[model samples]
Target: MTPTIALLLIITFLLSTVGLLVLIWSISTNQFSNSQNAARTIFTPGEEGHSEDPAREDTSAYKGDSKAAKEAFTARRVQDQSSKPAVLIWLSSAVFWLLIGSFYGLLASIKMHYPEFMADSQWWTFGRIRPMHLNAVVYGWSSMAGIGAVLFLVPRLFKTPLRGTPYAVTGAIIWNIGVILGLGAINFGLSDGQEWLEFPWQVDFLFVLGGALCAVPLLLTCARRTVEHLYVSSWYFLAALVWFPFLFFIANVPKVFPGATGATVNWWFAHNVLGLWVTPLGIGIAYYIIPKILGRPIISYKLSLIGFWSLALFYSQVGIHHLIGGPIPTWLVTLSIVHSVMMSIPVITVAINHHGTMWGSFGRIKESPTLRFVWIGALMYTATSLQGSLMALRSVNVITHFTHYTIAHAHLGMYAFLSFILFGAIYFIMPRLTDREWPWRRMISLHFWLVAIGILIYFVSLTTAGWLQGLALLDAKTPFLEIVQMTIPYLQARSLGGGLMVAGHIVFVVHFIFMLSRRGAMTQGPTLFRVRTKEISQ
Candidate 1:
């Protein structure tokens, strides 16, 4: 047997030995004993089986007059209101970038099928525009929005007033300036030629600085927390804050890894960008929003612990799976595969906690727009994560590698999962920050359907076309031109889907501006798809 295969065997044996040791320790220490008692630790006095939302009947009526509870609620509201300027700055910038990114993305999608559409313009060429779309959405839209939500959430969770609002606002401005310069550089042919790391290294520094400034308040607020119990959401947020800057700095440094090693490092950073950075933000938002709206705790905090640690452990190594069949060591690839399979542990644990929380509360989806968007996003998280694990398998990777199928899967996580969760967060948080309801309820519904249907179409068409393309590439008799020809129709369909998504984004931006300007009928309750008789009459 080859040395690589022998190494793989050795590693597998070591992992099995570790597992055996852990099992033995569990038994010897009676860790599994009193399972019910351990499970009860997730709850506080009188809060079991209860909704966390103060507005919920179970909570509001009984606890409304309790002096300490009322005081805490008032303090929390003050923190939420104080963080508004910073959150608005970040989120508005995010939405603006969303529109710009959508334009770049739709243009790139169209150019795939119609090469002549913008052939004369070097700046609008597929080479530049595609990366621009990627950086714009990933950094400008998703990262900013996640930061905004974190700013809003950390203080509320800690029961402390936000300490560094001015710094956070400055950070938002600095971050936006960095994104602007980076995109301009990309358009002017100053790209680093790396996929996700296209922006020049100087530009990368600004992001690091801006992100550090943004992170200070969160860490300080967390440190000065009044509450004793740190929610699982806070853990995810804190871990992400720690993970992203390290990944960003290591990946962008010059001349560290050369050639094949550089390629491996690039993929490692790219994959972890989603897994550690964006995924945690999305999951953290879901952890808060789902239960906050439903007014209940997550089904199992024990499961949440398993999910978080398992994700951190397994996801870190799984990035190597993207480099399968490359010049990398075979043992590394095998290890990634093992970790990828183990990822199912966290994915399932999260799925159970999130979906289990929603079990009997499905009907509330219709009444509340925030829950509807977040629920669908949370469900997609499970779907995309499982699909990702399967794709990491060598068998599946052989078929889907270097194909548009990968694009479909990325969107299933990025747009369908993370973006949807952020969208829900924007909807929920905006009203509270502005102390105003959404101006147009119909616009919110329109925005949801357009993007939902658009992503469905985008994912389905590209996935089918990619599978066929992959199969054709494997056949010795298949001509290269035939493979290219097969993807054209799907590319056209992708453009159409992209168009719909862009329209949805436009509606969202307009609605957001209206809310910011206080332009609609003022109402007393949360905005719902269908207004109740009591609300309508009032």
Candidate 2:
């Protein structure tokens, strides 16, 4: 076994030992006797019987706290207004980088089929631009937008204004600068040479510093929250805030591990960035948006908690499954496989909560742009997660590991799931932030169709192509050149799909700019999709 595996074994053993001791200590002290009190601590006085969503059914009669609830609701809106400046900065940065990233992604996709498209410029080579696209979207768009949503949610959830707006704004600026510098470095061939950690180590500190600065206000706000019981969404936000920086720091420590150990660390960091960092942000936002728009609570609070804790337990280990066939120890890979399968717990639990919450309210999607985007995103989360868990198995990994199938899966998670949720959130938050309706509902609908159709085409074409490619690889009679030729049509299809998504992004940016400039429709009602009188269900 390699040194890394040995060290991991030792660490696991020690941790298990410590956990066992803690369990014994707790049992001896009769800690389980008051487990109900601990469980009940998650609920505030007069809130346990009420729906968690602020827009929930009339629960004022149940708790006899109608006046208090009204006051709290008003305070949340005021807090949202106060959070506008800083939140907008983060969101604006997110949108800007999103546009930039989409173009880079399109260019990269085009190069896949037509390699000569950008051959004239070394700066635009696939190697450089691909990493540029990844970083721009991952750190630039997704992180910034997720942070913006968190900034917006925290104040309302905690019933307080964000504590340090100036610092958060500074952090957004610094974060953008880091992305710019990192992408520039990639363009010049100065990458650190890994899939996710492509940014040179020199600029890594900017992200660390910027993320820390952004985190301070949220942490302080949480600490000083007016609400006694922490909501499930808050739990996700707080955990993501802590997980991301720590993961980034450890992963980019600059030549700490070498050879097999380095590869192990690389996959561990890469996968966790998705499962731990971004997944929480996406799930947290969905948990809020789904119920908030539906005017109801999740189907089961206990199930939500189960999902959260199970995710924390299973996701951290599941990352190692990416290195299943590598030089790692067999036992370690098996452990990860076990965790991967166990991930079904959280995935099903969350699916039940999110989809069940939106059960009877599916018709609302016609009138609510936010619900349309978010609901589809939530569905994709279930699809991509189950796909991921299945792929972690050795049998499935052998076929799909190095194929474009993985790429399809990644986009399914990142774009269809995470980006879609972010889009919905922006749609919901922007009008409230600007105090203006979107100028055109048609534009929003067009944007959604373009991207939605694009991803559908993108996912289907690549999944089929990758499966065929995998089969050919397994066949000894198949020529490598023949496999390459077979995938060309799919690659071209990917570019076409990417082009549509890019167009959608452009439309979104234009709409966002209009809203920010206060040029939106001068109407009091929200800019919802037009529905025929007969189609209106509620």
Question: How much does candidate 1 score in TM-score?
Answer: 0.90
Candidate with best TM-score: 1
lDDT of 2 by residue, 438-466 (tens): 78888999999999999999999999899
Worst 10 residues of 1 by lDDT: 54-63
Q: Provide the overall lDDT of each model, using Cα atoms, as 2-decimal numbers.
A: 0.84, 0.83
Worst 10 residues of 2 by lDDT: 54-63
Candidate 2 is scored at a TM of 0.89
Poorly placed runs, candidate 1 (over 4 Å): 1-63, 523-538
lDDT of 1 at 149: 94
Instruction: State the lDDT of candidate 1 residue by residue for 291-344, as single tens digits.
Output: 766656777877887798899989988888888899988877888888989999
Could you tell me the lDDT of residue 340 within candidate 1?
Answer: 86
The total of clashing pairs for model 2 equals 0
